[model samples]
Target: MLTERKHTLILIILLVSLPVFALLHLNSGQIDLGIGTMIDSMFSFNNENMNEVIAREIRIPRMLTALLVGGSLSIGGLLMQTLFRNPLAGPYVLGINSGSSLFVAFTIMTGVTFFQSDLGMIINALIGAFLFGLLILFFAGMVRNQISLLLVGIMLGSFTSAFISILETMSHAEELKVYMLWSLGSLQKVEFHQLGIISLIVFLGLIGALLISKQLNLLVLGEREAKSLGLNIKRIRYLIIGITALLTGVITAFCGPIAFVGLAVPNMVRILFKTQHHIVLITASFLLGAIFVMSVDAILQLLESWMVIPINAITSIIGAPIVVIIVFRRLR
Candidate 1:
């Protein structure tokens, strides 16, 4: 049990470290711009300056994308784990990303001009994620076993992948190329202009998650207890699903299916904080999640001279070990 002062101190450290890390991330690129110039670019509209342009157009958006994607997925993961009362549950593992991807494939591979636009893709992704979330909830009611539920989720993912494979085969070469690149995942794909809407969506999801923090904490005591406390269990479950879908869908729409942040970060938060308090968990997850992805991306940028690694691959590399450790503990 952490003291309140300790929690406050930890939260303050995380809050302060975010912008500092963002600065470091901005400086990690190939062009060695001074800190002053980079800072200036954020405020000043100096289109003629190449360094400022790079900072404004490329680095800023990528950094912000990593921040938003990391935080959103972590929260989504937290929600899924809480809703299911399972340590391993997450948007990625339970096929929410697969659902979003399947819809994105439909939008991209169909060669519809309107659907290829950012707005079109976001809408489709949200619908797919929401429907899949409901589907997962439905199955949760049917099965008594967590492992069985996880297996069903895996099967759902495989089913979606098979459909995607079919789309890849029948699609035009250009369309196929586009989808392939997107599926590989890249934070650099997001632009400065897109950040506004992305931030807004993430903000809304975060607010929703926070508003239900009390309900989430009650849920930690078990569904029956929560219901006995006059917590509308069904409504809370639906809300969690909706918020999870929104957070997961938007991130997937922009960042592709980032694996394991949703699973790994929230678990890390739980382990580090050792608390079942949703407010603390959510806040820590939001900050730490951003910090985690930003750190990975910064390392990648530093190594960009030698090689480029996909963001998805690196997160999976880091998250997989955590998952294994968790499973081992659960087995014991």
Candidate 2:
């Protein structure tokens, strides 16, 4: 009863803060539109006015993108952790993000042009992430030990990084410049339509995660224990990995490879909730992830007055230390 009440309080806090932070996100910037003006512009739907145009077209989409991408990455990390039975596991562990990045780089640099549409980049990213995910799945099947699977994931990440470096070296300065900026990561590039698509994908992936939450909890015990309970461990593991890949692929394709939100948010949720139940942890992680991303984005906007810094840089600075602390604590 106390746990339920605590979770209810956290939910209420998140629900209240979400809009407040979003408003702060809207009001912030060099233009400095007030709350009343922003609200008026939102209702008017007429972009004839400058403030409305900026608010509607620029800030709102970016804010939505941050929420969706942050939520997706956080859930992806949670799924990875459960599947691998490793607290430090993240989307990048299986080379999913690196795979997406490689494909994006190839499209921009080598003129490979796999999917020649507005959504081309997203399609290519999904393909790359899926392929890498399959590779990881196949290798995981071959290996019995968890540590070996982790080593394989690390090796795959290293391979993808090396391939990206080779592509960078061969590309022209203009293409290289574009790829570098994307690699740095930013939320400023999202469009309204893209936000809709990202939101839908993220929502679907999260729902899939929720449906399998019970299986995830079972798997957290041990393979033998899960099997004793009649859980389909193999199928559940594959499903989790695939869903995680889809979530990571879509976010990376649209928002660039965001760092640390995936790694940090799940751990934060686990600690905050003080329970390993996937049902509660997943919901808490999603809300906390959205809040953390928006808060960081708000800070970035404030910092832009002095200079523009990549979102990834800001997140890494904050997230890496948290990761180290978690690792050391776990070791002890």
Candidate with maximal lDDT? 1
lDDT of 2 by residue, 224-276 (tens): 99999999977997788778877988888777889888888998888788887
The regions of model 2 sitting more than 4 angstroms off are 40-43, 112-116, 137-152
TM-score of each model, in listed order: 0.97, 0.91
Backbone collisions counted per model: 0, 0
lDDT of 1 by residue, 202-256 (tens): 9999999999999999999998899999999989999999999999999899888
Candidate 1 local Cα displacement, residue 235, angstroms? 0.9
lDDT of 2: 0.81
Candidate 1 colliding pairs: none
Which parts of model 1 have CA positions greater than 4 angstroms off?
none
Q: What is the lDDT for 68 in model 1?
A: 95
Q: Model 1's lDDT to the true fold?
A: 0.91
